[model samples]
Target: MRFIIDVLLTGLAIFLAALILPDSAVSIAGFGWAILAGLIIGFVNATIGTVLRFFTFPLNLLTLGLISFIITVLMVQLTSYFMGSKFDVANFWWAAVFAIIVALIELLLNSIFGSKDRD
Candidate 1:
C-alpha cells in the first residue's frame, strides 16, 4: 500500500538522520517503533508542514531553498516531539546536516523503489 511505502521511506530517512547526526540516537526496540515514528512524521508533515509552508510562502520565496532547511529542522523537531524521544543535535548546523543526509537517503530509496506511486 501507499501508506506502507511512505512509512518505509520515512523510516529510512530517520535512520539516515540518526547515522549522520552525531548527537542523535535511535533505540533498537524493533522496526515497529521506527515505522510508528515514520507514520507520525508523515502525518505531521502532511498536516502541520503544509500549513506552515503556506503561511511562510513569502519567506520561502525570499530565502529560496534556505527555508527548506529550516522546514526540515522543524520537521525533525516535530518528529522528536511526536515520538516522545529526543533527537540531540549539536545545534542547528548539525540538524541541517542531518536533514540533508536524510533527504538524500530518502531520495535514493524512492528512486530505487520507483517511488510510492506504484504502491
Candidate 2:
C-alpha cells in the first residue's frame, strides 16, 4: 500500500515536472511515459542512490547537501538512459531543471498526503 502510494506520488511528480520544464528539458510521449519514467527514476533513486549518497557523504557535507541536487539530476539522466525513446533529456542542465521541478512537485504532494512514519 505504501509502496503504491509512493509510486503514484513519483508519477505525478514526473508528469508535473515535464509540464513545468522547458521545451528542451525533457521530451516524453505523455502521462503514460511520465509514469514509466517516474518508476525508473524512483527505482534508481532508491537503490543506486542510497549507496551513492553514502560514498559521497563527505562531498554532501562539504557542499551543505547541495550534492543532492546533482544526484537528483543524475537520477533523471539514468531514467533517460533506461527509457530510451520514452523519455529524453537535453543535457545536464536540463536534467537539473527537471530535478528541481520534480522535487518541488514531490514536496507539494507529500505535504498534501502527509509523510508516513518510517518506523
Candidate 3:
C-alpha cells in the first residue's frame, strides 16, 4: 500500500516536473521508464537525500531555505542521470523552478490524501 502510494506520488511529481520544465520529456514508451526512474529517485531521496540534508543542516540554516531547493535540484538531476536520459533544464534556475513546482504539487497531493505523516 505504501509502495503504491509512493510510486503514484513519484509519477505525479515527474509529471509535474515535465509540465513545468520545458526540456523535460518522457516518451510514451518511457512512461514505464519514468515510473521506474521515479522509484529510484524516491529511494535516492529517502536515503542519500536524508544524509545530505543532515550534513548540510548548518548551511541550510544559514541560507534560510534556499539549500533545500538546491538539494532538490541535485536529486532530480541525479535521477535523470540514473535513468539514462536527458531530463534537461535551461539552467539551475529552471531546475529550481521545476523542483519547486513538483514539490508544491506533491505537497498538495500528500496533504489531500494524508500521506505526509507516513514517514
Give the candidate number with the greatest TM-score: 2
RMSD (CA, Å), candidate 3 to true, equals 3.1
Clashing pairs in 1: none
Q: Where does candidate 3 stray beyond 4 Å?
A: 24-29, 86-90
The best-first sequence of candidates by TM-score reads 2, 1, 3
Error of 3 at 1 (Å): 0.8
CA lDDT for candidate 2: 0.83
TM-score attained by model 1? 0.75
In model 1, how large is the Cα lDDT of residue 17?
59
Which portions of model 2 show Cα errors greater than 4 Å?
Answer: none
TM-scores for every predicted model: 0.75, 0.86, 0.74
lDDT tens digits, residue span 1-119, model 2:
88778778888888878777766767887877888898888789889888899999999999998887788789889889889877989899999878887888888998888785431
Task: Please give the RMSD to the true structure for each candidate, in Å.
Answer: 2.8, 2.0, 3.1
Give candidate 1's whole-model lDDT.
Answer: 0.67
**Where in model 1 is the C-alpha error above 4 Å?**
23-30, 86-91
